[model samples]
Target: MSTTIVIFDPANASHAALLPSFADIHIACIGTDHTIATFTPPLNRDRIIQYWEAQAADAVPGRRIIFMALAGDSDGQQQLAGYVVLFRPLTETGPFRGSVEKLLVSPDFRRRGLARKLMDALESEAKARGQTLLTLDTETGSPAELVYPKLGYTQLGIIPNYGVSPVDKRLNPGTFFWKQL
Candidate 1:
């Protein structure tokens, strides 16, 4: 598999056009994969679009950074396999920390180390930008929660009822993790 990681540039119309594909990934994760996220089935597509569009509004260097994984399919067409986001303060001053968001790998692309690769790139990029620490949270016992410590992230703590599962609509505990760059 030929996989390439690209930093999203929403200022470019072509790049903005790809936002729908990104949303589709999230939708699949929730509806098909039954992953825990900010939403569940019977989702409002417009809400996802708006949320992603707002990211473009905050696309400044210090405000947000979105990285997307693209791979060539059997048909020789490139598709989004996964993506990750790193967000810092908008002022670009007095902050050496960033928050990790949306570390998503398409179900079809799972077990391929794509999430690891995306995280590796995110850490490298964050360090390059002078960030000293990164933080993220995921469903307490989810696969993602288990993967972080393997990526050098230290568990902070777990909060009960931090999120709702997409599949069962049950309140779930969430685990927080952090890594020093």
Candidate 2:
């Protein structure tokens, strides 16, 4: 497989367009093949569209939102296999002084290290932008739960019912993860 690691920010025109591709990848990643039924966030078509629209080149956040996409190549084909989104925190003591709102990998592309590549790109981009802290939340059953701590992310407090599983009415607890750059 061909893999390219790069850092992108929504302010860039190309990166902004990639946001929609990232959203599409996320949706395609959550399914039986990925076994993410227990961790899938509650998302609808409208919400997905809103998310992509919010990342437009001119729709800048008060603090910029950095987007990182990992493209995988196979059979002379290139496609976005994973992505991450991070924003600088406005708070004085937020862990890592930044928050990673989203991290996703295509279901067919999981277990291929694409997620790790995306995370690494996010970390590098964050540090380049002078962000020292990085924070993220994942459900108990999330595949990243184990990989994250191993990746040097310290476990923070947990938020009960933080994850609303799309398949169930009940919520799954979410553990927060953080790391210093």
Candidate number of the best TM-score: 1
Model 1, 3-96: lDDT tens per residue?
A: 9888888777767887887888888888766778677878888898788888867875448899989998788888888999989774457478
Over 4 Å off in model 2, which ranges?
9-19, 32-47, 57-64, 70-77, 91-96
The 10-residue segment with the lowest total lDDT in model 1: 88-97
Q: RMSD for each model, in Å, please?
A: 1.9, 3.7
TM-score of 2: 0.77
- Output the worst ten-in-a-row residue range by lDDT, candidate 2: 31-40
TM-score for each candidate, following the candidate numbering: 0.91, 0.77
Model 2 lDDT on a 0 to 1 scale: 0.67
Q: Report the alpha-carbon TM-score of model 1 versus the true structure.
A: 0.91
